[model samples]
Target: MVVSSGPLNPKTASYEFNGISGVLGITFGLPLLCVVLNQMIRPDFYIVGLFTNLDIAELWNHIKPLKWYLTNKELWTYYLTWFGVLALFDVLLPGNTIDGVELRDGTKLPYKINGIALTSTLLATLTVRWQLTKGEMPELQYLYENQTDLCIITVIFAFVMAFFLYAASFIPLAHKNGKETRERILSVSGNTGNPVYDWFIGRELNPRLGPLDLKLFCELRPGLLLWFLINVACLHHHYLATGEVNNAILFVTLAQGFYVFDGVLNEEGCLTMMDITTDGFGYMLAFGDLALVPFTYSLQARYLSVSPITLSRPYLAFLSSTMALGYYIFHSANKQKSDFRQGKLPHLKSIDTKRGTKLLCDGWWGISQHMNYFGDWLISLSWCLATGFQTPLTYYYSLYFAALLVHRQQRDEHLCKIKYGDDWHRYESEVPYKIVPYVY
Candidate 1:
């Protein structure tokens, strides 16, 4: 496996977003985003200026009665349980550590593949619990009630992990030579001179605990599996609140569950993804995977749980088709890209770039530069739509997703252009558009 490395002095050099934007986003922006979401998802009518059109005076009246406390019990039990179980399951479940992309120093990081089992086991457990307690189940309602605690718990965990990783990166690995020590333990991009950025971006590429790859394990399991579990809880909560499960709620649950399932099944595909290959494990990924994904990824479901709504069979059919089309494009595009990398796609091999890497310019790759991103955006839109647009919070998923994809695509193209140089320009000339076919 080619240990893919970035340019020697490439233009798309930043990942920490370390400057003003990076620091603010990590230190302030992320936590604030979750806080606002948690405030908006209250079961009793909550005044959310982000969502509702109520005035400050009206909002003040609503919030004045509420007592504010920061201590979190559910997050500790729930998040820790999930994270601990993930670590345990990674061992109990049968999957070998597959070698990841080759590092620039020629080291192949090994990753364990047990996501499918993890997801399936969680679903089975939820099912059996639900069956055991037809009406006595309390965890679902408790989760919905104490989401704020969950949010805080993850934030604390993410920051603590970030500090520990940053400090640990400085620990000297015993080696024959100083150069070998750096290569084996530290990362190239994240080894920037700045301490603040290094901490945020992560100095070590892959820190492990015993046989466990903490970076890979945290990113894939825990929060992600919890996301599915949360959806299950939301489904239960919705049913408990309302006598029947709304078709819209069911659709969102199934879509999200499928999304998680697909990721687990196609996790090998994830190795080739920019996140796994390019990103460093730090507060960004830590918060995102451990907190953002599990808590906020199910924003639509949370909203629906609070405010139940149902769409017609016809509308449901249309929405299903839209999501399916997006998933089809998403699944197929990734498969094509993966197959091309494996030399299964005959044409892509001939279209070699100057970097000795081949560029795909056919099939879905021929259409949009980031077809998978487009598909993700479309599916995200569908998930938001499942909540029926009563509040702005319902649309938050698709809105944030759009901004995220656009920024990520731009970042990717900038880095790719620097790496591929003129070949990327030529490919851009052929592709022309970024995401949409005819529109920018």
Candidate 2:
């Protein structure tokens, strides 16, 4: 009878890792495995490990002797053993699932996996790909004779495991929730039929286009990631056969995890699934944020691996700093608003003059009503700049993100105007300018 020292409790095997711990484990373990796999298989693909004090060229020159470890067959076997262990542990851990309603006819929907679970599976495949490719694709002759069965089996296994884990965890979660999502939805009353009917009838009369319908669309649903994932698999078959996964594939697999995790943590944005569904454009836009930008624009490694980024390290670092500031502002402002709404913090009225018991306008929100958005744009610019001075495709994502946020802001303003009436206008007057401070 022995007790383990790890976070997982042996007494209750059902226990799992908390959010931060689980994320940290994945972050460290998964990337390390990818790097190790690469080193073992295609040791020629380099790492730019610059210690805080060391210079880049000096470090690269220093590590040149250890390069032989890359081609060692035995090293790869060692790496794969660990990779398999982590991958199995990741799948077996039984993570959180999102259980929403089946809006039509008040039926209960079962637990569908939240985004992080789905994204992890994609990353595992990329890990396998980089391992197999070892940096170069196999010749067609070798593919047919030695490795076709292995490739097929790997692909089928990865797909089946990802799907199985997702279904197993999510279905039960949804079943347990039992129509709560539906109740939240149905509680909001409407008479002009569904969103389509409301759109046609209300367009002429309302002009501003009030809540047309409450029904969340299939396209807007995060479940649509399954479709995008399928398409990616189809378009890149050879990568699987040779284990030479594309650089774009790898970048996207990582970036998507960031997007999904961000959405989950914010939590309020999840409610927006129902909030903006009637706005077909908003729905499309959300899909773009969750899926397209992550998959497409982050394709920098695939296209520009050979190209040189014109920006210097310091400049990029400065840009990254500015972006961090923006995220701080955006996140801080949102936090303040949430606190005020939840009554966790006392609401201050103005920046220079704090009217008792109102929102604190002195911090990030003090600069402007939507200063957070400015910070967001700054951060986005930093990311876009890091992609090198390449074609617009790389930067398009940031641009689209800005446009979407602005549009969302406008929508929020309109909704506030209708709901808050005179209070919104008064609030606007007090907090002049939107997004950028003193500029717009």
Candidate 3:
């Protein structure tokens, strides 16, 4: 489906957030929550009696010193180097070029689909580095040892990048006639006339550095690849501690690794998602892509590294089946919708919207408006379940993801109602569910 118009000017567009209070809450609350969740994953951090006898002093003692947060020079250098390598690979690797959905400006941005190639190259490079250096590389070990520091640095970097992007958005761009203009260039959506809100939500739809699309690159590359790498580090740490690989860590690593691999392999699919097609690049995306994703999403593997669990044959079978089923549903549902949009499934039933877009009502979509979310949730649950309930923190990803998807589904439905009007009501009437068939 085509976009109705270009990005709304931030100066003139309606506010998306509830108000300054809502914006402040998300901007501050999420990062603080991320830090708390990371700390809660520690093996010694007990949560059983916290509510009954909360100790403010004890909690403060657990927090690292201010100097500690400032002193991870090697970790900082390693992160910057990793980002540079990925950026290099993004520019150097050759892949099929796919055009993104048309924006309000009547132009489609061409995106490079070399994520699989980049993933393969990084793996091969790491392997070579290990063999050549006789496994002397301390970077992975550093990642495991100083995860908290790394997370802090990532959050800091996200803030820096967000500020830079927000500032850059106001700079005048030269037009084809060599005249400068402050008008919306591509599609922008986050201008709320409030600096803090705009910074958190984003001011530019697609921020680029020459040919590199920062949002798309971050969405598919660093956070995801680093998430897989963090899992690898945790697996390696577990082996070092126990002198053998356990099925628990192995399962979590491979399961999440597969998810990341699939995402990178099919990176082009993201071009049609809301992140690429709609949301502006800002602190929200930056923090999510850079900090929350790699650090928090790896909680299962991280927890297993410190507190390993042995899965029985039957339990292993169950978890494996769960993951496989989730993957099948998630992948197939998404593919069906994508195909329908591309007009490859002309036989599918759809509701004709007034805006010339068709609301799909067949196949997986017929089951629910977002069957893929159910599948995705299942996958997350399996990951958490593999951790075996040592601490509730390991389940954070699944819980957070479910809430995020539900909120996103609601937001999307609201937009659809506005865009399609009565047609959306008809479509909803026919489908009769949002994310679960015969349930939600």
**Among these predicted structures, which one has the highest lDDT?**
3
Candidate 1 ranges beyond 4 A from true positions: 1-18, 46-52, 55-75, 174-182, 185-188, 348-350
**Model with the higher TM-score, candidate 1 or 2:** 1
Candidate 3: what lDDT? 0.83
Tens-digit lDDT string for candidate 2 (101-131): 3333333333323335434655576567657
Predictions in order: lDDT:
0.74, 0.40, 0.83
User: Using TM-score as the measure, what is the rank order of every candidate, best first?
Assistant: 3, 1, 2
Task: Tell me how far the alpha carbon of residue 88 in candidate 1 is from the true structure, in angstroms, after superposition.
Answer: 1.1
C-alpha RMSD values across all candidates:
3.7, 18.4, 2.5
Model 1 agreement with the true structure over 293-397: per-residue lDDT tens digits = 887888888877777787988889888988999999988898898888888878652357877878887898888899998998889888887887567777877
Off by over 4 Å in 3: 1-14, 43-72, 135-137, 175-182, 186-188
- 439 in model 2: Cα distance from truth in Å? 1.5
The best candidate in terms of TM-score: 3
Query: Model 2 off-target regions past 4 Å?
Result: 1-125, 128-260, 264-269, 272-296, 299-311, 350-362, 388-393
Candidate 3 per-residue C-alpha lDDT over 226-269 given as tens digits, one digit per residue, 9 for 90 to 100: 99999999998877777899998899999999999899999888
